[model samples]
Target: MKKKTIIEIFIFLLLLVFGLHSDAQEDHSKMNMGQASNKDEPRVTVDVPQDQQSKIGLKTTKAKKEKTLHTIRTVGTVTADQTKEAHVHTKINGWIEEIYADYVGKAVKKGQPLFDLYSPDLVSTQEEYISAKEQKSAGSDIAKVALERLKLWGVSQKETDRLVKTRKAKRSLSFDSPVDGFIVNKTAIRGMYINPEMELYHIADLSRIWIVVTLYESDIATISVGDDAELRLPYDLNKTFKGKISYIYPEIETETRTAKARIEIENKDQKLKPGMFVNVEVKKDLGEAVVIPDDSVIDTGTRRIVFVKTSQSRFEPREIKVGPRVGNSFIVLSGLKDQEEVVSSAHFLIDAESKLQAALRKGESQPAGHQGHGK
Candidate 1:
């Protein structure tokens, strides 16, 4: 009887130990499932009372599809239009006999006499042409060749006509201005010897001017040829000038990482002088896109989040992909729908509360025994 009683007690003890082992396994499995469920759950929305929202100064703006207008403001320097510039040089070696356009900045018209030049070569060519005319008809081959040589030697048409009419070689010939412009540079002096290689005058037409502006690499895509720009002089804020982008430089500056763009503006009044600094504003329309106020975004380094108003008092934290910022708004590439209201002000506090609530919920889902396991 004692042996059978001892066997029964051992069997009972074994059953009890197995039952405890199964219970422990069940608890561990339940804990793992609860943690997994918490991990897979979506982010929860937070609710704020109306009075609390007023105290926090919460403001909301609706995300909507609209044209993104970006204004790029920069500084530019005025420059002369290179296409309308002229460098006056003589084709023959000559002595300056007289100077009519005497000073720099003097405006001269086309065909206007700039100076009188005396050259032995010119005089000899003229004499030969006169002799050829005397020996043969004016249209004869020899006479034509002599006349052509004189013309190639830089003798003006008017001077040639005079030589034909008078049949006399003049000692001094007048050199005319080739274009209507102000002489920005002058190297000619009375009695100074000049040659074909010498530049006598540098004239520039200021009727049209160029404003060169520097654009950062980020802003290069916002500008294009024919885009309108507004320019304002630093000295004259009340006066505004309008222009259009005429060219964009192909290469970017390595040091500054910027490129240059040229804006053409009419300067018929000659008010915009070269080298003057002006403010430039270029407005670019980036077509239509979904956008939200810039203040509504919460950038947490790894990702961007925005609080979307789902109901009267509920704000849902949503992750979104955003593009470039346009003015006070941001272009939303995804994650939010059009016409959805987003919190634009006082969202930081809401974000803090939402994080706190999430932490509490995660703690509640954890097993009670494991709650203080790390500590």
Candidate 2:
């Protein structure tokens, strides 16, 4: 009887333990089920694969390490180099009795007779010289010295030598030009009276020229002496003139608010004429400025956005800070790196595609039995 009782107790204890284990397992399974339900379907949807995002009609350029630059261009006029310009004037009071110059556009050489003028003061002086030579006295030689004085006053050898051979006082004497240049200005007409200190003509030496370039107030800082410049004139389409920055105006233009920069250029061929219209571009170093192609940027009022190609098909829009313009590029001050890739062309199309894809992914994140399914 005892042995049978002991066997029954052992069996009873085994049954109770198994029953508790089963209950514990059931409770654990229910907890696991609750935990699985907590993780719902993704909150949004993504239709396009991540690999094909950036290929939506997008063109790109690698961010390069380059110097930054900023410059301004303006319309300018060609001017005569002031250092080479001269005005021809008459020192002796006279009339334009006979103008050997003939016309306004005549070329004259140094010591060449330009016009003849009749003056009582001149004729009397010549007569005095003749009388001095005939008397043959020391005092008379002093008077003859007057004849040589005419030569000192720009009388050519041909004319002065003739005066000695002819021994006759010419009614009018010739006045010569002091320099070789074109007659840029002619104030005295054929018969006009020319007074002492009268400006008869203006001769401009055309071998050198100047270009007056205007720049916006902002660009005045980059231009400096010795910087190189280029000009394209309307008359010469195939030609380009090189020049150097020579001077800058102290003040800006009142109406246009621009600073005028003077560039000196050599025109030994006389191709650059005064008042000629030209386009000028200046080149300078901005000193390691960050930059990108001019076409790579899109400016919205709130932000300046650039499309960065993160991977083969993933383009991300990033807000960037730009400094200034340098020819066909912009100086990227920040928000980009040297080796990253950015969309340089066709960025607008890619922008639209990325936004649309983002919206679609957001919609598909909802579960099949949850909200937004009907739409």
- Per-candidate Cα lDDT values, in order, are 0.80, 0.67
Give the TM-scores of the predictions, in the order they appear. Answer: 0.76, 0.61
Where does candidate 1 have its weakest 10-residue lDDT segment? 19-28
Q: Which pairs clash in the backbone of model 1?
A: none
| Candidate 2 residue runs with Cα over 4 Å from true position | 1-62, 67-74, 128-169, 285-288, 293-323, 333-337, 340-375
> Model 2 over residues 1-375: C-alpha lDDT tens digits?
578546545543443333311112222222211221222211111122333333333467776777655555667899888887668776667667887666666777877888887777678777777777667776466665787677665556766777777767778888877777677888867767777578887877667888988888878877788998888876675789898999998997888888888999998888888888898888777888656787888775545667776555445567688776787877777898887888787665444443333334445556777764567
lDDT of 1 by residue, 158-263 (tens): 8988988898988998888888889999999999999989999998888899999999998897678999999999988889999999999999999999999999
RMSD of 2: 20.4
